[model samples]
Every structure is written in C-alpha cells, then in structure tokens.
Target: MMPLSMVASGETVRLIAVRGGRGICFRLAELGLVPGATFQVIQGSGQGPLILAFGETRLALGRGMAHKIYVESFMRGGQECQNN
Candidate 1:
C-alpha cells in the first residue's frame, strides 16, 4: 500500500489502512475514510492538500493527513493492480 498523497489525480483507490493514533483514525473515520472505502483522487500532486471525491462528496485533506492514510490504487474497472 502507498500513501494517499502519492496517488495521482483522477486515480481511484481503495483505503487499506490509516496509520496514526486513535484520534487521527477517528477523525478520518468521521470523514468516511475507513478501510475498504473506495474513492477517487480529485487532486494529489504531492503538494498542498489532496482533494478526494467520494461519490458526490469531496474532501480536502492535508498532505500530512494524506500521508498517514495508505491505499491501493486501481488499474481500471475497479480492478486492483497486479504485481509483475
């Protein structure tokens, strides 16, 4: 899994894990960032806050916060990338 900040814009990813303290996890969970949640990266340029789209909802997360969240990027059709 890679940090959410590393994902490129327009890429869809599934949340794998959130690394941090309980407070951080709770905050992310409140924002609907729980594990297994699938969302698209609206903006993740590795600079500034990363914007994520969850269906009709969009959330702007700081780079630090994004770094704490790990996700697996999808290739297409919501399929997970296979290691080669």
Candidate 2:
C-alpha cells in the first residue's frame, strides 16, 4: 500500500490500514478514516495538504499525517491494487 498523499486528484482509493501510533491512528479514525472505507482524492496542494472524501465527509490531511494512512487505489473493473 501507499500513502494517501500519493494519490492523485480524482482518484478513488480504499483505506487499508494506519501505520502509526495511537494518537495519529485515533485522530484519523475520529475523522472517519477507517479501514475498508472508500475515499476519493478531491484536492491536493502538492505541498502536503490534501482533501479526502469518504461518504459525505471531507477531511484535510497534511503530508505527514497522510503518509501514515495506508491506502490502495481502486480500479473500476477489478479488485483494488496497492498503490506504490
């Protein structure tokens, strides 16, 4: 899996796992970024900030924070694949 920050705008991805401590993990979870949740990359500042959408909720995540959130890109015709 790759970091959420690496996903391009308009890309859809599935949250796989969080690879950080409790504080970071808990914070992301509270923001609706949980395992198995599908998300889309709405906007990215390219300098760290990114807008992520899951269901109807949107979240702004920094590069450092997003890097800890492991995600796999979703393809329309088949199973999801881990992003590099």
Candidate 3:
C-alpha cells in the first residue's frame, strides 16, 4: 500500500490502513476514512492540503495526516496496483 500523500489529484483509491496512534486513527475514522472506503483525490501534489471527495462529502487533509493513511490505488484498464 502507498501513503495517501503520494496519490495524485483525480485518482480514486481505497483506504488500506492507517499508521499512527489510536487517537489519530479514531479521528480519521470519524471523518469517514476507515479502511475499504474509496475516495477521489480532488487536490493533491506540492505541500498544500489535499482535497478528497467521497460521496457528497469533501475533506481537506494536511500532508502530515495524508502520510499516515495508506491506500490501494486503482489504475486505469480495470487493473489494481499497489505502489509502496
């Protein structure tokens, strides 16, 4: 799995695992970032916060927080790949 921070804008990815303390994990879960959740990266790249869209909700995540979340990216052509 790859860190969420590595994903590019417009890419859709499924939440894999989170790497951090319990508090952080709980907070992320509260924001709908639990494993198996699929979301699109609306804004990423550079050092700014990432804008993620899932359903009708959008979450702006900082680089540090993004790095703590791992995800599986679904590539084009119906192929799923893990980039770590």
> Model 1: per-residue lDDT, tens digit, 1-84?
788889999999888788889998889889787777899999987689988899799998899988888888755334443321
Candidates in order: C-alpha RMSD to true structure: 4.5, 3.6, 3.7
How far out, in Å, is residue 39 in model 3? Answer: 0.3
Name the regions of candidate 3 deviating beyond 4 angstroms: 75-84
TM-score for candidate 3, residues paired by index:
0.85
User: Over the stretch 11-82, how does candidate 3's per-residue lDDT look in tens digits?
Assistant: 998887788899988998898877778899999877889999998999988899899888877553223433
lDDT of 1 at 15: 83
lDDT of model 1, residue 39? 96
The window of 10 residues in a row where model 1 has the poorest summed lDDT is 75-84
Task: For residues 1-84, write the lDDT of model 2, one tens digit per residue.
Answer: 677878889999888888888888788778777787788899853775898887888887788887778777777423543422
Question: Which residue pairs collide, candidate 3?
Answer: none
Against the true structure, candidate 2 reaches a TM-score of 0.81
Alpha-carbon shift of residue 17 in model 3 (angstroms): 0.3
Clashes per candidate, residues 3 or more apart or on different chains = 0, 0, 0
